[model samples]
Every structure is written in C-alpha cells, then in structure tokens.
Target: MARFYCDACKEEFEHSSPSKKEYTDSFFGCCWQYVAPCPQCGKECTEKKEPQKKKRTSSSGGGCSSGCCGSCSCCG
Candidate 1:
C-alpha cells in the first residue's frame, strides 16, 4: 500500500489500490497506457509524489475540476 495526500481533504490517505499505482501497473497489464483519478479529489495527477499543500477554500472537495473521465481522453 501507498500513502497519497489528498488536496481536497488536506490529509494523507493509504489504500490497497491507489489509482496512481494502478495507472503505473497498467503499463505492464493488459493496457499499454494508463490513467486514473484521485480517490479523494478525482484529480488527474498520476505522478507518485506527495500532494502539494493547498488550503481548500471551497466546499466542492471531491473529484476534479478539469471535467475529466468524460470528454477528456486521459483514460485512453
């Protein structure tokens, strides 16, 4: 398991299956490319790095604002 800092919640979280790791693993899996969103914010950041400390001043704390997983083709 790995720890991912959620900017939405401003806290770190650990999980058995982080989307970042899953995205990386996908390269060796059935898919040649990989992409996923954050579990807390659904952000499209896939790099395995600590999330920047950003004070969330809004109530829409979950998911992303880029309007991904739909018109965006990052999942491909």
Candidate 2:
C-alpha cells in the first residue's frame, strides 16, 4: 500500500494496490501515468511530503480601494 496526500481535501489516503502496474492494469489500462484520486474529494492525490509554512504579507496602500474592480494599476 502507498500513502498519498490530497491537497484539495487536505487529507491523507492509501491505495490497496502497491505496484503501479497492477493498479493501472486493473483500473486504467495502457496508461503508464498513474495518479490516485482522493476518496473524500475525488481529486488527484500526490505523494505525501513535509508541510511547508506559508509566508504572510500585509496589504499596502498601493492596492485597490473599496468598490474598485481591480482592473487598474492600483490593484497591482
């Protein structure tokens, strides 16, 4: 069994079939690329890795003002 992480649902999942060949042959025949879908959200799951912290930034006055559609340079 191989463990996979789903970013969409933010959950970890496991597949019963260990080998890619067996899993692909049973489900997706002829396709060499095998990506397991998350059972919770049905999105493609990737191999689990260490989570990284996201950097936070404060919004500056240069950003778009209230009621602005953000199509102007101020949005940038």
- The most accurate candidate by lDDT is 2
> What ranges in model 1 sit over 4 Å off?
20-76
lDDT of 1 by residue, 1-76 (tens): 6555556556555556544233235447543322345667776433346558998453343334454443445434
Clashes of each: 1, 0
Candidate 1: clashing residue pairs, number: 1
- In model 2, state the lDDT of residue 41: 83
Q: Each candidate's TM vs. the true structure?
A: 0.29, 0.40
Candidate lDDT scores, in order, read: 0.49, 0.65
**What's the residue-level lDDT of 23 in candidate 1?**
29
lDDT of 2 by residue, 10-71 (tens): 88888775334224476657554336878888887666656799996544443565554555
Model 1 residue 10 CA deviation in Å: 0.4
